[model samples]
Target: MAGNSDPLTPRAKLAVTAGKAVAAASRAAGRGSGSVIGGRVALKLDPDLLARLAQNLDVVLVSATNGKTTTTRLIAEALRAAGPVVSNALGANMPAGITSALAGGSDAKYGVIEVDEKYLAGVARDTDPKCIALLNLSRDQLDRAAETRMLAENWREGLAGSKAVIVANADDPLVVWAASSSPNVIWVAAGQMWKDDAWSCPACGGVMQRPGDDWFCGECGFRRPTPTWALSGDHVLDPHGSAWPIHLQLPGRANKANAASSAAVAAVFGVPPQVALERMYQVQAVAGRYDVVQFQGRDLRLLLAKNPAGWLETFSLIDPPPTPVILSVNARGADGTDTSWLWDVDYTRLTGHPIFVIGDRKLDLAVRLEVANQHFQVCENLDQAVQMCPPGRIEVIANYTAFQDLRRRVGN
Candidate 1:
């Protein structure tokens, strides 16, 4: 079957039509992006609209605490080589967003979706995805997402009965624990540079030993699973140890890991490794995650780092010394009101570089930087901060809302 040619009942078809009308009305009124409202109405009407929409398409689901948006984009881009691929490019990962994407691309034969970590199980079950990518899990929105371990348990239970092949990051203990019970699994050593959240075994609650890069739990014998796909620097190695060079326009080791995982997922769908990497190289940015724009006579590169683990991975991508960096933080509902995760990040790595701080929570970041003995100046606005820095390409890193705000302010 091609596209959403799935046999939908008359009521389901009517529900989809009504949902599209509501979405069009929302866009006409300039209320919002209109993505959520339509999906909301559609689901209300049919109550099983997602499953109906997902029927008869090759679906790939990407979920994690971080990099889901980018990874989804990479997978979607790679899948485009085969045919038309539908995806939520707006970084929407909830049931509403997934419904919106599927509805919008009802004619597409392939679907690549980024799913919210909390809703992955339900979405996976509904979509019956052919492959599911489980990236690293860490502490995010404690007030909302609860602890990282609980989310892993949810994934563990949800994935145990899933027939879809699981492609997981073997380096992350949390991901390992969550995907261990999966019958069909493809482990990828996509690299995990941050381990603050995975110090203990999620299975037995015993302290995990990290001797070199491998991790193991002495009490339960839980350990990092051997990877079928591995990333060695910029090279991606297959099970036979043959390697393909991955060149990405998006910088960072985390992105390389994303590329590796994407390649693995693509391979499962019959896309060649070289072909996947070639498509990934063509991707410049993912919904403004990494985009360079001219603002106030300066070239500014935007990056989003919401949690401690995110910050750790993003910080590693920054050029050392001599380059000025802008750090923006916000404690909004979307960004997790608690700014305490800032202290968990190793701000000391940025000590020798010139840092300018700006955001609703800029003072909190300034205080943290001071405690870390990193020199930084507080700026009232992003443009002013960009001006304060020496003229050239400046890296601007922000949390969720702050990054969105700056992206709008910069006119991109």
Candidate 2:
């Protein structure tokens, strides 16, 4: 993604200045990082502030139902091997926060935008990124966002004429279909662990024919594209069949999948896979995700998992059996105000653990766990939940707001 470095108009400059001032005030007041509010204020003053601020910066947007923040962070870090990068790493994938981030880092050479799935098209049009990483998309925030297929169709339609090189996930049928509209694409076999959303074809209402790893729509002739890059266990194979092992401080296969795709996107900016991954390996924690903190006499590893697809991936990263896990869920506006996705997650996998439930929608989670025949304890808050767990190495999985609450409580 790189836009012109032309100076902003008098009004745009004033709007940017006002937004930055408010953002600084917000930080000083401890009202949380002022990205969203400041951006809102700026856009209120000048609706085109995002496009104005995006000037002169090469942009690369990373969008997906899950891993938006982490992938943006990873892609930013990887791109750092080439030049300075400004990114919205706090899960603020919307226009406001992104505009604020671009305004904040106006001097940077590149921008890594973490766009919400629903807002991808507009953001792509505004930023006109040099490259975009289309990670896997699944049902998320169903109460607010469009259906999975609709969102994919939106991407296909929205990015129809963009010259941006799409680094798409080959393993995800929805992503493959969406990226197909783009003339330039670098396919990466970034694994899709949760496949329920891709059983039906988006190109046409038809069953996807799958034999082994290959997926094809029998009715519409839509199929999985051959990836130029593929993940083989912990290693990533490039277009030349050269294997580059990905080593990350971040835990789980999901992070490995992120790193693999990120390397490909970074390569679009002239950073080699080995160099990009080396920079990526330096990323210890994204925001507060995968961060281990000692709270209430226990070493808690905070894992953010908002939907069923996310929970499935998070479950694979958690400590097994008797390790004891804390699961928190919130139905706040940001959390989609829908807890039905809990039913889709296989909570039976957590059956052997001492599960502690917390947050505004703890009861919803408790009910789902009960239906899965997994016993759990309901706690009023994180403190009570942590107190119920045994000391040392506990894993905590929370939705958006709940995860942020944990970070705030831990003073991160």
Candidate 3:
């Protein structure tokens, strides 16, 4: 949450009242998507609403190209051991959503916010968070986000002046470059699974060598910083050489990496490594991510993958060969209009799995699968796709809005 515990001015109070009214109306009309419209109206009325709301709160901002929402949830869960926390739980990472969340949880003493990468600096500036988690960066929403390097530069500039201690990923070259200059930083070697976005050094534009787990720039002396917190197997190692086992319900190496990063931030706030990991393991799902639901009399596991990097991570979690999987891709506004990134994903890894393609862009995915020499069936609807699979448990992987649609269908 954003605002302080102190009494609000008449103008700010009016804005808050109006925003709540709008939010209530939106929910009554089946449109309350958690601060989409209400937050906008509130911010329009009071331009400095976020700054006012963020006063006296120990805020931790989580930003990344992927996994910000889940990472934010993990941090919030860990922080609950301390006290009440306000967070954007609906997957909205913009200023308006943040303001609305803050306003709703005005009494909370801690705020764990999931911030969009482009707006991280602005939000961090307004909130003055005690800790900021810098997760991995990669190409996402090319139409809106442009080049990834530009974002790295923005993060670098934004974090340079912030007084908050930064918990950064040492494996990500871009993350290293962005948080390198920060006065206080805790580096975590949360294994980099995707290196496609970090071919070149962000500092000198030189080719980066990944001869081993560590990366170094060829032209410049810039290299991956030694991390005090590193992930070894399914455990997180502290500065004192103690390993804490992480047991998260969320599947994939990506979530393990997220847990390690969240543990680092929790440690900064005096939460023990074992306690943080225990709290994180209790998170069965974030919103609809990694949710198991009954759809049309069949059990289905719902997973969301928004881009090439995300898809790569999702594939790693799925059972190989013999398992039937459904992939739904929609080129909606939320999912980005361009599906060109699909080609960059290594669908070849799923060579032997039975993939049922569904959604608006199923044909495009079918073409990719065809080129990869993978076997797939194109179905018209979710029910039909589920019926096509064998009885019992099935896996469903969708992108952004399609995942939301599935969640709605299951009444989640």
- TM-scores for candidates 1 onward, in order: 0.97, 0.97, 0.97
Lowest summed lDDT window (length 10), candidate 1: 1-10
Better of 2 and 3 by TM-score: 3
Put down candidate 1 lDDT per residue, 1-412, tens digits, no spaces: 3443557789888888988899899999987678889889989999888988888689999999999999999999999999889999888789987898898886688889999999999998899888999998999876678699999999999999688999999999999999988999999999888898998889989999999989999999998888999999899998788899999999988999999999999998889999989988889988888898988888888999988889999989987777899999999899888878888988988977899999999999999999999999999998788878986789899999999899889988
**lDDT (Cα, tens digit) per residue for candidate 2, span 209-316:** 878888999998988888899888999899999999898999889888998899899888899999988888888988888999988667889999988899999999
In candidate 3, where is summed lDDT lowest over 10 consecutive residues?
Answer: 1-10
- Please provide, for model 3 over 1-412, each residue's C-alpha lDDT reduced to its tens digit, 9 standing for 90 to 100: 3343577778888888888889888988987464768888999999888888888689999999999999999999999898889899887889999999888886787899999998999999899899999998999877778599899999999889678999999999999999987999999999888899999889988999998898999899899898999888899999899999999889989999999999999998899999999999889998888988988888899999998889889989987667789999999898888888889989988877778999999999999899999988999989889889976678899999899888887898
Regions of candidate 3 where Cα sits further than 4 Å from its true position: 1-5
- Model 3 CA lDDT for position 81: 90
Residue 38's lDDT in candidate 3: 87
Pairs of residues clashing in candidate 3? 1-102, 2-53, 2-54, 2-102, 3-53, 3-54
Clashing pairs in 2: 1-58, 1-59, 1-129, 1-130, 2-57, 2-58, 3-56, 4-56
Q: Which residue runs of candidate 2 sit more than 4 Å off their true CA positions?
A: 1-5
